[model samples]
Target: MLTVKPILPRFGAEISGVDISKPLSEEDRRAIIDAMNKWGVCVFRNTGLDDESHIRFSRNFGRLELAPLRRDGKGRLAHRELFDASNLDMEGEINRDPSAVMYRKGDRLWHTDSSFMEKRTSYSLLLAHQTPKEAGETWFADTRSAYEDLPQEMKDKIENLKGENSLWWSRKLAGADISDETIENGPKAVHPIVHTHAGSGRKALFIAAHTKDIVGMEPEEGRRLIRELIKHCVQPQYVFKVKYEPGDLVIWDNLCTMHRGGEFDAENEARDMRRTTVREGTEPNSKDDDDPFTELFTGMPKSLSRLTAPEAEA
Candidate 1:
């Protein structure tokens, strides 16, 4: 039987006693799902998963989305499902140049993965292949708890609001040099600022860094509300942090939580994290016939285009 220990007063759990390398039995799978329903995040330590097994394991839960494509038309991992969340370059070395790593600074802002995708993103199963020596922890906020704690008046006001999210907007906010082509044609998604979480049957604030503005509202006023809501969502009571170990796997529901990456000495330390994102559904949303995310990967890696010469980048 799996042992689940709650790590925080409101949410987050640590699960143990499972060999994830092999297929999980239906009983074990349901228990994990139950834990996920109760706790927005679950930490599994010493999972002993490599890239292949990691991909295989996440498949048991839901359909995997293709990780963001690289501009150079190369992939380090065999599976497109494995998204490289590392501080390292494609060559697996630490990136020291500030400009070359500027785009990554966006990760520091609280956001849900692939929220800007047309399809609703559900769970993010992130595995640590390598860990930084210090200070590379990730923080998560219980948006569900945060939502329930909101003032009744505030809740009533925002009950039907929607946010227009954009991938380029966030990249631009992080001081990345987004190409004109991308700004004009990038992927955009509109989602409710507040929605009921299916598993837990609780309302959760789905707002995050990708939420650029509110739909059908004046820009500045809408953004102010988003900022205010985010402030409330990340209050100390709803927050917790996790420092990863090499074999740790942290599964989080993007629907009910917000997460941000912590600062590490990227110049000197290696934090090779990989993730398989399971969207709420396998099919694209009604509006997306051609994959809407195609525009994001068009140019060279935003950092490389600005910092390195063509030959040096290669």
Candidate 2:
């Protein structure tokens, strides 16, 4: 039997009584999923899962989407199916590369994983392998609760509106030096500002930092509205902060929440985390006139040209 206890009144729960590294019984799996649907986020302590087991556990919810091959400063894939969410380089040491560090800075902004992709992500499972002694945390906002608390008129105003999201735009905001071509070619998606959950039939504010503007609204006004909505969504009551332990694993529903990485002393401390994302049921609505850059860089970086190149080549 599994045990679940609410961590916050709004939308987070802590679950125990099962080892996630081992295969789950059908009953246990369903129970976990149900709890997640209700709470939007579930935290499992002391899971201590290896990469293979981590991937195995994540697959219970839906098909495992292959993560884009992201290289470290040395141009090496960190893990096969996991998105490296650490401050470390490919060699297991703290990363000093300027580009990698700037890229990581974007995590501090609130956003859902894979929102800019043609295939939106459903669930995100992040496992903490190493945690800093102080100030390294993840903050999650309950967009479902935020949506429910909205005034009827405000809800009506956004009920049918779509918001555009772009990875390049977000990275640029964080001061990352992204090339113009990369911005134009990168994945850009449009999603409903107010989305109804398929399973629970509840609505949630789907806007986040990845959201650049509303589809039909004036650019300045749309950005201002987005900023206001984000401010509203992250109010104290709707937020939950998790200070990770080495073996902590948090599974969150990307459909009903947004999260951001908390500030930490990256120069002195290390934080190692890996994430696996499950794809959403419906295809995403992309704004790009042609296939996004994600397709071109699916398995590896496009600059690599061919995978058969000698290992010595950069």
Candidate 3:
């Protein structure tokens, strides 16, 4: 049996007492689902879940979204179901690629997982494999609460607006020179800005870094509104940070929350994280893309440091 304790007043919960590595018992599975339904984010501390177990645990809930392929056409991780959300290169060394460092910076922006995918993701389970000495907490924003708190006029204004989410757009914003061919090859998903969350029957704002523009409106006007809503949604009261310990797994509903990576000493320390995402709809919408570009999003600052170093510049 598992017990769930609420970590925040309205959104997060901590669940304990189940060995997440093994096949779940009916009681444990039901309890986990119930907790997930009520709490948008659930933290499991020290459950001892390895890569295989992590993938196994996720399957009990929904189908796992395969990790995007690397530049070599294979997932960087041993398993395609596991996303390599870390600062290490494929060889487990600090990455030295200049363009890749910039692409990784995109994760620092607040966004939902898989929003740029055609079908979108329902949930994301992020597990910490290694932690830096300090800083690097992951911050989450309660978008469901943000939507409810919206002014009636604002709600009416965005009632029918749909946001076009693009991985290329975010990469460019983060200063990555993604080739035009790569941009044209990636996913650009469209979803409603004011979405009625099917699981909770609550409304949530769907704005994020990946949101390039709102569909069917003048681009600048739509951008202004998106910015306004994001500002409101990420107010201090609606946001919280979770500092992870090794083996910690935090699961959050992608439909109702937004998250950003906290700053870390990227040039010196290591912070290795992995994730498994669950697809939203029953039917898969698009082909699995080999996203060696953005899949490499993580901390790697050695090259960036040299660019700004006085000795290197002069």
Candidate 4:
């Protein structure tokens, strides 16, 4: 039997006694899903999953979304369904590309994955293949708890408001160098600032770094509000930090929480992780056809990007 233990008072749980490398029975899946709905984040210790096994396990939740191709058009790391979240390049060496470095820096800012896409993201499954020696933890904020703590008046004020999200806008905030074409073709999506969890029917504050501005408000005012809300959501009591280890898999509900990668010595340490996201629903948004990163990969070479083994030297 799988054991679920609370890791934090309000938001995270540690799940043990299940090997994710093999197929999960229906009962196990239900228990896992129930735990996710209750805790918002679940950590599976010692999963020991390879790229293929990772994809297989993630599919148990829902249909997997293909990762966007690298800007270089070389190909994606491991399987097409895996989003490469490593500091290393295709050759398993520290990446020195200025653009890639800047892009990775944006992960330090709290945000939900694929929020700029119309289809959005349901859950994110991140498997740690390698970890730095220190200070490379990931932090998660319980937006569901943040929402519950809000004043009734504040809740009422944002009840019907929507925020526009753009990938280029977040990159700009991180001071990343991006091309005109990338911005022009980037996704712009509008989603409710307050999201209702599909399975649990609970509400959560959904604003994050990708949130550019509120739909009908003045730009500066919307930005100010977003900044304030993010500040409130990340208060110490509402946050949980995950210090990763190789063979660890952390699954988080993108709809109810916000997360950011912790700072580490990218120049000296190797931090490699792979992620697979499940879409919230079956149908793709019409605007998904215009996703800038998707367009960049069209006609790109098909090559399997390599992953650094956990035992590999930094």
Best by TM-score: 1
Residue 181 lDDT, candidate 3, scale 0-100: 54
Per-residue alpha-carbon lDDT of model 3 for 1-314, expressed as tens digits? 68788777888888888888788887888788778777889899987999998988888777677654443564447887787777767667766556446656888888888787666788788888989889878998999998998889888988988998886677676776656455545556798888888878888898888898889988799888778888887899888888889999999888999998989987778778888877775432233544432343222133332222110000
Error of 1 at 251 (Å): 0.3
When 2 and 3 are scored with lDDT, the better candidate is 2
Number of backbone-clashing residue pairs for each candidate, in the order shown: 0, 0, 0, 0
In candidate 3, what residue range of length 10 has the lowest lDDT sum?
Answer: 305-314
Per-residue CA lDDT of model 4 for 207-283, tens digit only, reads 89989889999989999999999999999998989998999999999899999988899988988888888888643
Question: What is every candidate's alpha-carbon RMSD to the true fold?
Answer: 4.3, 5.8, 6.2, 5.4
Residues 1-314, candidate 1: write the lDDT tens digits.
99999988779999998888788888888888889999999999998898888887888778776754555567666667777777777577886667657767778888888887778878899998889788889999999999999999999999999998976677677787777466546567899999999998999999988898899889899989989999999999999999889999999999999999999897898888888877785532222234333354554445545433111100
TM-scores for the candidates = 0.90, 0.87, 0.86, 0.88
Superior candidate under lDDT, 1 versus 2: 1
Query: Number of the top candidate by lDDT?
Result: 1
Tell me the whole-model lDDT of each prediction, alpha carbons only: 0.79, 0.77, 0.75, 0.79
Model 1 segments more than 4 A misplaced: 97-99, 178-185, 282-295, 299-314
